[model samples]
Target: MSIERIEKRQGATLVAPALLWTLVFFVLPFLAMALMSLSHLEGRSVVSGPDLRNYAKIFTEPSLLKGIAVSLEITALVTVISVALAWPLAWIIATRIPVRWRRLALLLAVLPFWTSYVVRSYSWALVLGEKGVVMNALVGLGMLSEPVQIMATRSATVIGFVHFFVMLLTLTIYSNLIQLSPNYARAAEDLGASRWQVIRLVILPLTLPGVVTGAFLTFVLCIGDYITPQILGGNNELTLPQLIMLQLGRRGDYPMASALSLVLMLIVTLAYLACARWLKMERV
Candidate 1:
């Protein structure tokens, strides 16, 4: 074979495994879930018959719709908070921090991801639990007469998500920020613009692609997250993922669970597309 043919063959060989893995793990399961969403639960078994009953039930059931709304609200709130918090931190780390410290900061940002998701979530439970560290500190400071109930509230869920995802957002946006030339801001400053004006006019606009990317990722992950909401948000908060888990596990309603999963997937896909379109426009 010619050199070009051999290179092409090698490239295809390398891609084949990933393609196969995606098909087997993601695509196949998604297709199955789509089929299952159109099915009906007949006792313990999921009856494989084409039906819109599951979709209809999802809309008709107020609780399910409420769960979806809650999920979206939480996703939006967490995305906003995570991105807002991440931007300044990422900017500082990327532009202001010393070269030697940058690596350490990046490592610290990603270190939390090395721990188990459940363990990290339960750590939040400890920090925010009644008689937990935060509560004890607040009580000591006379912020409250009793330990605040942060463990099982919507606020707790949002906080936990922020804690869990802020690192990811920081790293993503920081990577983008690091690539940006400081000259843009410097030039803006040389033109008699103040620091705030430079950032508002130049830096923020340039970093928007990163901001959008981080927000989109954080939103998707937070929306799909079951553990954080389940652990941190007891009976008070019911996200769509938690509801789907309940249907699948507690209620043994596979069809309903599948339907809910499909709905969540659609919402996530739409959000991703919208983010992609926005990014494209920003790039243009």
Candidate 2:
């Protein structure tokens, strides 16, 4: 064989294992789920067919439709809040903090990630409870006549999501910020731009890639999350993941659960496409 042909063959050989693994783990399972989604439960046994009834029911059923809406709303809110809070904190760490303390700051920012996800969700549930520390402090200081309801509500879910995602977003935005040339900000200021103007016009534009990447990740994670909403929101409403669980566990309807999962996957795919388009535009 020719030398070039040998090199190509070696490259393919190196990638073969990963390709095989993906086929076995992801592709095969996804195909099975897709097939399941097209079948239906007859009493307790699943019957095989390319039925569209599950998809139709998802759209027509009020509770299922509401689950989709709730998932979208919560994901959007969490993404926005995480980006908003993380950006400034990232900027501070990358620009304001001294080099000596930067590592510690970053560590502290990601401290929550070390804890178990389920534990963190339950902790937040307690913290947002009526007699929790947050409410007790507010009531002690007379901020309210009594503790208000935050736990067992949508607000609690949003708070829990925001707390976790902010750490993730901070890491992305901080990496982006630290890579930027200090000269860019200096030049903008020398040209009579204020600090806010410099950040708005120069720094913000350059960091769009990291911000969007992080936001997209946050959207995917938050949308598919079951633990936080389940514990913190106290079953006040159902998100898509919760609905999928109900179908699988309570109803024993794997077909409906698979259909809902596919719908969630479709939404995440759409979001990825949107982010790709915006990033391409930004590059142009």
For TM-score, the strongest prediction is 2
The whole-model C-alpha lDDT of candidate 1 against the native structure comes to 0.88
Badly placed stretches (over 4 Å) of model 1 are 1-21
User: Per model, how many backbone clashes are there?
Assistant: 0, 0
Model 2 RMSD in angstroms: 1.4
- Per residue, candidate 2 scores C-alpha lDDT tens digits across 16-126 of 999999999999999999999999988999999898989999999999999999999999999999999999999999999999999999999999899999999989987
lDDT of 1 by residue, 207-254 (tens): 888788888888888999999999888878699998998897886988
RMSD of each: 2.4, 1.4
- Per-residue lDDT for 125 in model 2? 81
Q: What is the lDDT of residue 72 in candidate 2?
A: 97
Pairs of residues clashing in candidate 1: none
* Whole-model lDDT values for every prediction: 0.88, 0.95
Q: How accurate is candidate 2 locally (lDDT)?
A: 0.95
**Candidate with the greatest lDDT versus the true structure:** 2
Question: How far off is model 1, as Cα RMSD?
Answer: 2.4
